[model samples]
Target chain A: MPGKALVITSGKGGVGKTTTTANLGLGLALRGHKVALVDADTGLRNLDVVMGLENRIVYDLVDVIEGNCRLAQALIRDKRTRNLVLLPTAQSKEKDAVKPEQMKELVKQLKDEFDYILIDSPAGIEHGFRNAVAGADEAIIVTTPEVAAVRDADRIIGLLEASGLYDPSLIINRVRPDMVRRGDMMDIDDIIEILAIPLLGVVPDDEGIIISTNRGEPVVLNGRCRSGEAFNNIVRRLEGEEVPFLDMRGDGLLEKLKRLVGLR
Target chain B: MWEFLSRLFGRENEASKVAAKERLRLVLVHDRTTVSPCLLETLKEELLDVISKYMEIDQAGFEVNIEQGDDSMALVANIPIKEMKRALSRTKN
Candidate 1:
């Protein structure tokens, strides 16, 4: 069977949209699944950088779209995993350089060959975002457990529903369990209550993500990272497996403190 | 007493909740329904105008608020009897 086309999107920027894409792609690929991650941000691409495949990109998505190169030529195989490929976007061209129809066709071509086609959508509900979701089998809405992020996620949920795409799952990123315990930040339940989407993964705030990204290594490469485990859980959920949410902090005390400080 | 104690005990929590509810309601009202605050105000004024000509409206106690969450904006107008009495007294007199 062909793979699932998953669009990882968050309407708000700086809410870990790209991180979710990078880690989830690696997580699924690590599970022996053939995964292809398409950076749909177009000109403002960073999936290549996050995936550590920037040096390998001789041809990009635009190259394949414009017939400058074959799709295979554009696809850069992961130095770490053969099953994973990074379909990078051209940094020179703007988001509208490639149309949604073109993206649809491209994802369709890769569908049969891959187990998961994860597209990283640009922040904001614009042409870039639309093109990213044009061929999504399902959408994994990434958001932090903040009111602003959750509000934006709710808007994206509305847009997805308006577009006739319902049942999009939620990926709560940077959830500080301590803050959640203290009620300084919105907890998983609060987020779930607000977004009302099925939970795919609950990623805790981890400083290691920055270190890994700085090294051109995805957090998923490190099994010990909380974010990595969360990504793995999401991948398993995508495979229709039931994996429990991973609370980075062992106790809910922090969640309570966050609530006390009005950070939740 | 318990309510007061709970309220006092969870003062920070209550404040955050109140703040979250207020902000979310304000932001999401426009975000979900695409209705601007000016338009909503205009609508409220128009609604009050049309209704005031009839039985009674408590203009001071009247509130046109938008409920946020789930489907976003849910317009709720609350006009108090005291407001209607006050309006009726001011206008009729």
Candidate 2:
């Protein structure tokens, strides 16, 4: 049976697209499904580093596309999970080096060999973003709670719908619960109202995420952290499990007082 | 005390969130339509010019806005006609 191909994208940069790709890919692999993580950013590749497979990148996606290496040879097997593989992008190549048809063909070939193919898209609606989303059956849009991020996500969702990929789910990342409770930051409800997409999961702003990335390890590997649990919920939801969204309301004394006085 | 009381009672008055949503709503209407504010202004000017030839319009009350429907966007124009000059000319003849 053919597997599913999903592209993780955000029209805005630094909204956790690569991190979500690494975690979700590893999360699926840990569930015993053979998964392939494709770093489609081409010139600016970081998925490999996030997955801790950067040092083993002997060949990359461009090598396979240009016939310099076989597809299997370009796939770097993860050290922790044998079922998870990384198809790193060529750091030196430009975004136009690969076309949409080529991406579609490559993902088609990958779908037969793996249970899931997760493409990590680059930021913006330009050639790189187009190349990343070309082959996917579904899309996961990641956004922070900031206004700019949500606005960009809304534009990306419109473009995706125009391209015939409708109903793309959302991942609200880097949410500061305290700020949200204080009405200083946009909450999940506000984001959903603007983006108008189904909720996938919300990842809290975690300092551990920085440490994990620094160590070239995905946060999902720990499972004890808040962001790690969020990624796990995304994985479960992807597998047809109805996982409830995390209640990220920080019930501090001030929050309680505000709620009592109807100031929240 | 008045400000504090208003803040206490207005629980849903999240200034930033409300502002962001309003800004996004207005911007996305233009973004999706690919219509610039300049273009809309030009269009309104041309529409008024063409319509004023046939009737005296309430220029101060005229309004143009892009409204978002369930699945599509519509450019709505409310041109209040004060008097029909063409009808007055016909009546005189």
lDDT of 2 by residue, A1-264 (tens): 999999999999999999999999999999999999999998999998888888898999999999999999999999999999999999999889999999999999999999999999999999988888899999999999886888789889988886678999999999988778767677888788877889999999989899999998899997767789889999999999999988777657886697588774
iRMSD for every model = 2.5, 2.4
Model 1 residue B51 distance off true place after TM-score fit, in angstroms? 16
The residue-by-residue lDDT of candidate 1 on A1-264, one tens digit each, is 988898989999999998889888888888899999999998788989888888887999999999998998989899888999999999999889999899999999999899899999999999998999898888889888677888999899988876667899898888776666655666677668766788888888878888999998988887766677677778788888988777644446686687578673
Q: Which segments of candidate 1 are over 4 A away from where they belong?
A: A248-264, B1-14, B35-93
Candidates' C-alpha lDDT:
0.83, 0.89
- lDDT of model 2 at position B56: 89
TM-score of each: 0.77, 0.79
DockQ of candidate 1 compared with the true complex = 0.19
**Cα RMSD to the true fold for all candidates:** 9.5, 7.9
How many clashes show up in model 1? Answer: 27
